[model samples]
Target: MRPSLSAFKIRANMKPILITGYVNPDLDGTAGMIGYAEFLSKTGKNTVAGVIGEPHEEAKYILDRFNIPYPLLLANANDYDEIVLVDASDLNGLEGKIDPNKIIEIIDHRQAHETDKFPNAKAQIEMVGAAATLIAEKFIKNNLEISKNAAILIYGAIISNTLNFKGSVTTDRDKAAAEWLNKTARLPENFWQELFSAKSDLTGEKLAERIEGDFAWFVLGDKNVGIAQIEIIGADKLISERGEEIIKILDKIKDEMQLDYIFQNTIELLDCKNYLVANDEKTKKLLEKILDIHFVGISAVRPNLIMRKQIIPLLKVELEKN
Candidate 1:
């Protein structure tokens, strides 16, 4: 049985804590902030879940489909005295909208991160499949009651981030969390297919929008690297038809962002493989060294699925060496 919401009241004389994620967050970030805020609130803390920029389409799909309320949209963290970041540890992802010194706590799952940037914050930077896994475990461990909306959000996030438990970064904790969350969310077994299909609509201008919306950049060693990840059902068909369009977008983004290297990693959900698109010789060489795939023309096919989170650490190790 779950406890009543009134059972846990916000303590007196306590300032509200704002929980948020990176700018233009994906499902993992969106779910983590919402779930963590509920966890803290249930523990008698005054916490509010907020979002800095627009959320990715995948996150939006869950919210709309499940009738889950959107988190408070925030332009910046100016109003909150204390901030907690979930599924976000990189300053670059924050896009200068959030002040690092004001952060109080950070919960994230990433191998390559910028946790050191938050000088005052205590961080839990683990390498789980999704930060949502950690947030779900908090509810399960504390034996606390979680709202249906939160459970649904976090469950969808776990499935999306782990690529339905097929991605390389998936762990036992993620699977366990998903199983527990399903008890509350009560979603169908085919929910993952529904969730993946929601984000697979990269038609016409949506192709450009999805690519740029999900793009992430990093400052590794002396070079700036930008990686755009697209998880679609028909990746082979998309790459075959719009390969030049993808290259054009990458080139434009690289020039606009002044990035040293850039590439697009298109993960085929149905096929469980990756189609990597890199335009330049430098980006191609870097990817060849890290992923060991020989590019024919502008793209290369990797037999197994490797997500951006898994690839970042490999890039860091190789780039830092040079």
Candidate 2:
């Protein structure tokens, strides 16, 4: 049974319920927390959005562009009576700031993690491409008033996560949510193109930040995998200039972190293509065969694959077999 928050209502004046995104929140995470917190507030639960870590450049840009207030940085959720997790539910993503037991609700679109920890919390996990899509749907379904800023954030998240609906994991729900949000948001026609360009503004100076911005760790087939993605406009140029250096960095990370595989993919947003880099040839060959795209040097050129959401599952299945 889907858990209901009706029984968990706030009595009189109390501390506002806390809602937070995972550490190092991306656009989807930021948007999801904002939208869901707004929804809960309207439902008679005072809620405040929080972030476990600083917003990434893309999320910060979108929030600033829309004039949406930034979520408060949360040191911990120990003081809050209830907590809602958006975009991510893993304990590692929380960085041990908030106890998993304190989470009262989880609204995520990613694969379930730490499921046992939140056994009593209401979980709304959908297989959609983006968590923002699920939250946007809540606004529409509950007939909640979506402020223009909220709509814009949700729309931006959907666009960013789905790569304008070109990503493999995008569903009809995501498209529908985008249409609904765009109706009131009326975002500029060039918003997506401009945002994509902005996201690809990584230069040599921001190389380390670019690598760690979207990094995640996963356990696949008894081996810990550290995966990072770099979304850029000049994938080929970047690779040609610093491919060796990037590989060396990945090698060091793999060894120091005891990661069996450290994979990095540079996605060219302009052409909607990707090239990959990894610490080892075995990992590269596996990705090539699984993604059905050969590598050009260290980068996988235009593999027609986009979104780590699509790639991770494929890797999991293959890794299990190995």
Candidate 3:
């Protein structure tokens, strides 16, 4: 999932914009999409947000909270001259939502290596925390108002996409952006406190569920290795309480799933003090002894907890090295 610009063969001249895909209607996905589209519109691009999939129920909460008008359901995608993709890490997943010939730019926080050859777009991927953080920045760059609801959505996006920044993908920019958005929009700690409480059923789900839900695998030589992300924000007290327990569970999942390699990163979402887990003692030792990192390497666990969007790209990076 490393960033690839092959899909974006930028044209010398461009046309109007039509932002599309990942209209999940979540704090991260929808807000980021809308925020970016708003930027295009302000620049006089014929911009619209398209959601190929159903919007998540939470989208309503965030949109209403921000009072930002949801983009109308596009009657057909071909009317727009160019398309900007947001939030979607996988472009192929956006089947039937757009005209293949019209894709022009992809501004996402994902690390998909497939840069489809399009002659009029760009791929702005910073395999870091939330895409919404980038979107928020774009809007702010345009002097757009940081409405209370947009703030909430961006904040939630920061939390969910980076797993509260516990994963390896989070950077100082992400934290700073989240902080800025929170201050401008007046976000409260109480909101995140409640959201973190919804545990991802760690009791006894299959190891495969934890691995599949949270991890993406890659073929590294003869061995198949995987990476998972867990973002824990400074604002959430619960992360400190249960992060280790979750790591142990993820370890069990790797063993049961017969994976040759496993890597886990437990990062402080608000900043970077990443905790880690690796299956191979040699790898763990190298990670700490040479890289000055620390982690617990073990086996057998359940399915719970995830930091998917960030984990997949990190997995890609490791695979290339392995």
TM-score for each predicted model, relative to the true structure = 0.95, 0.91, 0.58
Ranking by TM-score: 1, 2, 3
- Residues 10-90, candidate 3: write the lDDT tens digits: 432344466765433345667677667766776776666766555554455556555767765654566666677776645
**CA lDDT for candidate 3:** 0.58
- Between the candidate structures 1 and 3, which one is better when assessed by lDDT? 1
Candidate 2 runs further than 4 Å off: 1-13
**Strongest candidate by lDDT:** 1
Clashes of 3: 18
Q: In angstroms, give how far residue 224 of model 2 lies from its true place.
A: 0.5
Best by TM-score: 1
Choose 2 or 3, whichever is better by TM-score.
2
Error of 3 at 321 (Å): 8.9
Evaluate residue 219 in candidate 2 and report its C-alpha lDDT on the 0 to 100 scale: 80
Put down candidate 1 lDDT per residue, 213-308, tens digits, no spaces. Answer: 989999888899999999999998999899999999999999999999999999999879999999999999999989999999999999999998
Report the C-alpha lDDT of model 2 over 1-322, residue by residue, as the tens digit: 7555663453433778788878878989988888888898899888999887688899899888767789897666777767888998778788788877778888888763555677658888889988999999988998877988889988999988888888777899999999999998999877889889888776775787778768887887787888889877788898888888888877777878898878887777777788877757888888888788776667776557477666777788888896
